[model samples]
Target: MEQSTAASRPWLLLLCLAVAATGGVLQARAQLDSKGFISVDCGLPGKASYVDGGTKLSYVSDAGFIDDTAGANQNISGQYIRPQLSRRYHDVRSFPDGTRNCYTLRSLVSGRKYLVRAAFLYGDYDGLGRLPVFDLHLGVNYWQTVNVSTPGFEVTAEAIVVVPDDFVQVCLVNTGAGTPFISALELRPLKMKFYPQVNLMQGLVLDVRLNLGPADLTDIVRYPEDPHDRVWIPWADPKEWMEISTTKQVDSEYDDFEVPTAVMQTAVTPLNASMKLEITWDPVPQPHDLSPGYFIIMHFSELQLLPSNALREFDININGVRLSEAIRLVYLGVGVIFNEKPYQDGNYNISIKATANSTLPPILNALELFSIMSMTNFGTDSRDVSAMTTIKTKYHVEKNWMGDPCAPKTMAWEKLMCSYDTGIPPRIRSVNLSSSGLNGDISPSFADLKALQHLDLSNNNLTGTILDTLSQLPLLKILDLSGNQLSGSIPSGILKRIQDGSLNLRYDNNSNLCTNANSCRPAKMKSKLPIYVGAPIVIIVVIVSVALTLFCLLRRKTPGLMKNSVKPQNETRNDGDTSLGLETRRFTYNEIERITNNLQQVLGKGGFGYVYDGFLEDGTQVAVKIRSESSNQGDKEFLAEVQILTRIHHKNLVSLIGFCKDGVHMALVYEFMSEGTLQDHIEETEMQDA
Candidate 1:
């Protein structure tokens, strides 16, 4: 476990601008909206068509252009991502496995300068507790290697690429450094002049796009309100800054894209804005004394409409250098944007103070910071991907089979092998199922793997006639089917293939199985199976006859005896034909009494009755819910509960084992919920609060 240090690690390539040769920052002011902008929320399956609240750019799920197979390793699900700037990052597709997973961005105009950005937020999503570093690629060309040293921050990689083809692909290649995953992917069409001064070949990296304001505020400014959905988040320290809003209309001196109007509406100033405002910007913490270059963009607007005579002036000082001598504030509606010279990481603090001539204190509406990176691999094959998916589903194999199966070569699924030679799509070369306790017939999908070489299914209860298709695999060299219940004549074609020395076969320990083509026989079953099944039923029938005879005699002496007799077994099954395959047993009154010791040892009580702790004959603890004698909805609730419990099953859920009903006396047994009642915890909290 090594911690990344400043000396050994790459300088977090923080982006866009640095102080020019003359010590002034480069200010990129505009962009003309074009027709070809594609936004993709990676790993999303459905067509999620919506607009981003931050950028106001409309994006759809990646399914329209790319199929499921192309997204071989999309794994992130059910994680609460932060910022929530846009819905795009909620469910990510990860690459816990696979050497490379590529997303092909189609319908792109060839020869256009496309601005592509890929975002990643680890959020410790995999719970591995370690961040991953991997390469990001554009088709066959190398883009940028995304190194996420910190968790919970959305790392974005951007580049200006000239698309040579109609469609450009973004690929993520795992370099055996860490498990790579992607949150959001964006492909926007850009006009030639989007980045005027920067070299097109050297890509710009996005470090931080912050909207410094109150931490408690979840308000993110995006499109419709601003026309361009540039997301602005609030990050002001509540104790230091005061949220101030102006009723006056704010106007964009330039385009709204230069300084978003939504952010300009509200501003954060020092708590005592009536006095001289002083702000010390907090510098991002670094691993060592080394300085990583960064870009900062500050947004400001005159919140108050001041008289022309009362001039509001301030100086921008960064690390002790003034941007200019004296700056005059525009009227209430007009906004101001400042792109500061890049600074090195240190005890650096950005301060903005009002001059003596200023009528009002300084106010900052929003600010953003970024780190730059340079430009990035292949996607996994389609056929092998489909075949592997079928095998897992058919066998119901529950393993960490997330992400692409082979790309990040080191993370291939357990008990599986893939071909890793170079440019060609990887194929499933081998599958090992030995000692995995497999049963039922072999999945026919296994035969679809054209490149399969070795197939092992030893030490299992698998049965069924061998499919001749097994011999159809042209590359199969090793076939092991030993220690299984597979019985039947081996296919003649397979037998010939085995005899001709083309197949290395193993078929031992299956006594009923016939190896030779001429001596085929049907599988024979154990001779004692019928006797073992019929003996118990015969004993139960004789006992039932004697009990019935005694019940009839007792009915003559007591008229109510026949009414108390247990309803016929068929009566329980006649509940409108909706058993739904629930594994419930019909317990008799005597059996319930034996298990619950006449309803002793009450665990708890509900509206129904006393819940008595009991155990099955196998010593499995259960809770016997005996209905209260005064309960009104006993029969209805019992039937309703039975119908529901039979359909639902979960680890946290208490399993309904069986039920007993003798006239009005109803009882239900459930697997114990050892965690105790939720109400108990609530009551304990109440007591502590009191």
Candidate 2:
């Protein structure tokens, strides 16, 4: 919503007289305790926090709530920083870098109601001398468009919402007309019983909240006066109504709304007691809202003491339709009434008429009107959101990955395709992370997105074998793993799907990868001679074997010299042989099972196999990575790792103590790291800092 222009009515000049008579009644009030309130000065410098002198509300810098690289902080032009203006309007946090910048408000109770307000005062902070228009969003749904028409005037938007998650995100979206900026953000926890029309499917955006009695133009009712901090603007219409007030405080102890005593004590009645009290207004719909509806609430109280045999009662009417039979006003008592549903009419006229049996005129103290904001868009599915979050964190994919991944359609994360079905949350259909600078093993988090159809991880530095879980995706149609350093044989389930023409797979340029078991095995040589030459071939083979036997006997006598000549060939062989001589100790399969207590405790799992917690004979803790039978990693890869570990020495690298190469079992044993993985440690540090 844009800034509203106040009407230059003639009766506004007489408001000061009415407020002057009652000003003394508001003094000597207790200080308001600022609990459950989040007040932020958007661009305040440094990490300092302070209380505002005027409101006594605590304000803090927005550094911890927003990303450092998302925006820049600057002060407004000095000429506009008037003494009467709030300190928050002197500076702004302007987003000139991205289309969507968001501030995350955490530690909110889900399903609880809250009042969120965003204020903007464009004092030409950029020194451009031009007003900017932008859109604001509450999470993934559109709240309103902020069109700043005046340079020094402040425009504020407020909404009462039932937060759907533990936290809520307030986002400023650039509409290309100008850069988006914000001066301050505030949140106030509200009682759940208030605003009965507000629900999970809809929110109430404040259109107007006015105190209908004569008061000073600058005297806004909030904070210590109202307790709930609801901003109540002073309204006057002396042409047809006259103000009536009492110095006695209005009792609102039993009321849920608890309208401030200052507001309820002063009220307006018809100038002629015989005439009806009427109010008319025409609401302008927001740009994003075509058929806006309104929910209105009116507060009333009897300010004066009445004698016996005198009764004050009125009937409330809206647009010529009667809303109630009759409302009786009790002396020094307050009552609040609101519509159960929203009114969709463009024009509204409220008439309060005295009942036939009443001897007094009707009275009204306060009114609040709000436009219904539909929150039907459920945004992205939770499962897809969680999985995408994991993938983004794992790969550090920062290409506009903010807020809801697939929400609003126009601002979906880059390289992602989402499906939006009517009445259902959006689902991620495709993800392309090609050449995104991703490294290490392929994250298993991708498999958690059940609705995902196409995945492209090609042209990255990813290693490890393709996970077998990829073949389990029911809707998966395309899988691309090309142009990487991935090794090992493809999973059989994937191969079956490929052969049936159900899934299109890509794995080109990976030199070490093989298609199947037969393709991965070494090729055997065949003789070209016929059966007639078999006898001569056997005789020649025998003669060569006899010469080799004599040479072996001579080599045994010079074992030291033979060892140097044969060791290089044994190390370089690519065949699936387990006889490679290594410095690390080798254990039998039974010994491995004994050390691991029959593989009872699993440390973790990966593409190769599960890692088990084990202990050596000397009570040294170790992690044993046992290869699975269906694992794509073969004997060659195992032998290569063993040789590399023996040759390398680094303080950061885990020490390989031994290995297992018994029968068909293959395992690697290394010193256990007491701390968790590097990813866990980094996440913990970030959470603490945040």
Candidate 3:
């Protein structure tokens, strides 16, 4: 084991020198692998893609990464579009629609560290000259609040995070203070070993990364200079301190942070060698009245060589607490000291004092201060997230349903209730899509929500029997499926639960639906004839029969003539009842061709036939599956499929709209499943796992 630096000064100096010497060889410039980088120019026009001249990083429009309909794109005012400003800042994506708008960055590696950055430049893009204030969230956790109070000045927020999943969502939440807008978003992958404090449950929100001394204050070091793209802002106080620098490169090979050579080459020390170096800062304000804890790292490197007898040693203290004692510096060698835990204090003061045995004052080359952000909110339960996502895709739900379904509580998806427990990921409990224009069957995804207790899918065009899977939900207490076109009896398990008073089931106004199997069956037709044949009775019967025959003849000859005739009670049967007792519509082959634009757009091909994209007269999207001549299925199989599909309804199953059986041409029309096929979903799952 290595001896503690405080116990052995000579050993500390030797270790520093040896590590620096090993890293003495200069690194050659090479092309950085930016495949993991995501640079988004929010509000960029059209499907634009370009490379940034300054950073040589590729940037693309955010249209593909976000819901384009949720926000409007606008360029910053002409005054702010100067050549000196980055092109990203010249445009902005303003969210004036929903309360929360998000950009999903996908194709990421889970458990990897990433530097997430959001940039905002309020160049009066709206022309109202009003600055905006809003909250930003990373996935389901609150990252920071963005306050754009100054014009022409760019505001940036950065955090070093360890992503828990393959994708991360950056959301802008409207706080009603003003409209939310974003200029640019960027993500850069970093080595896992960097920022040791960041983990699955804790992130480091950057307060500042400072380069202690530099000839030009305006010069910042990042990207090409620092492989991890850490921004180092030059900081100095010439009034009380002076700069010490060397042209020779400083070695930082053994350091996990990998500080840039340029940043470590220069440092600041007190102007008077006898005076101690001190840096103090007040606490930064945070959102939601949070009292944040902080972690800090300080770097040191000696620029000048001293005589063997002349030593340079110092003791480091933060907030009057000694963090390290008797730290020795080596010439042109790098050393880093950081706190293992966070300091929960309102103010901070770091003092570097010369030890009694030291011959020179202390020097600080660079420093990094970060507020520890607790990512304790583990987002929604993964199973529930998957189930809810499947439900959304199946129904094409148009709510503000982006990102995690239940997290950060305030931004949980609309119409969803979640249960949040301490130390446990949130679980979805209730979903209400009542009167939401849902046209298909009840989604089986709802059953996947084991914690679910309440579900409302009333007043829809849903047309299948209740699924038995719904009854398997252990916690389900209430279900509403009223005012639908559903047929067939309710599931027996659900009925039992309702009978036992453990569940409240509502299935009113479903014309063909029934509570019992017998009620669902068609009633038998019976006829009777009078046995008696008296003279008066026969004359009356003959006169009545003659009147009935004339009425039937008139109705058949001119249907429009009997405008006020009483109609039959079972009027719903008039909706194209087939010989097989199914109520599904029968379309002519010509009608199918017209709906599919003469089979123009092919969606996919299956064993049965090719699927074509089409739209009904009312603009409803549909997928027409035309049977090929070489298909193994015969007319009997097609008829059987049509009969079965017309009897079953499920939220996860594609809805059959109509069928065509004109001559040799045969096709089945179904509601378009915009989310794609089961094979696509399986492939996506496999890729994510990989």
Backbone clashes for every candidate come to 31, 0, 0
Q: Give candidate 2's TM-score.
A: 0.66
Instruction: Please report, in order, the local distance difference test score of every candidate based on alpha carbons.
Output: 0.60, 0.76, 0.77
lDDT tens digits by residue: candidate 3, 108-216: 9989999999999989988898888899989888888899878799999999999988889999999998999999999999998887889999999988999998989
* Candidate 2 per-residue C-alpha lDDT over 1-690 given as tens digits, one digit per residue, 9 for 90 to 100: 111222111011101112222323434345446677889999998797888877788899999888666789999999899998999888999998778988988888989999999999999899998899999999888899899999998999999999877778899999998989999999988889878778889999998898877556578888878767888888878888888887775656566776777787678899765889988889777778777888778888777767887888887777776665578776666777777667777798988899888898899899898998888878788788879978887887767787788998988889999999998899999999999999988999898988989999999999888888988888898999989888776677776555444667777656565544433532121111111121223454564466457555645775553333222321322222334444566666776776666675576776678887665555444678899988997765665556555544444456677777665788877766544454454455688899
Q: Rank by TM-score, descending? A: 3, 2, 1
Using TM-score as the measure, which candidate wins?
3
Give the Cα RMSD of candidate 1: 27.1
Better candidate by lDDT, 2 or 3: 3
Report the lDDT tens digits of candidate 1 across residue range 314-386. 6556565555455555544443344433455555556777777676667777765554332212334666766
Candidate 3 error regions (>4 Å)? 1-15, 19-24, 27-32, 463-468, 486-505, 508-690
lDDT of 3 at 470: 91
Of 1 and 3, the candidate ranking higher by TM-score: 3
RMSD of each: 27.1, 15.9, 18.6
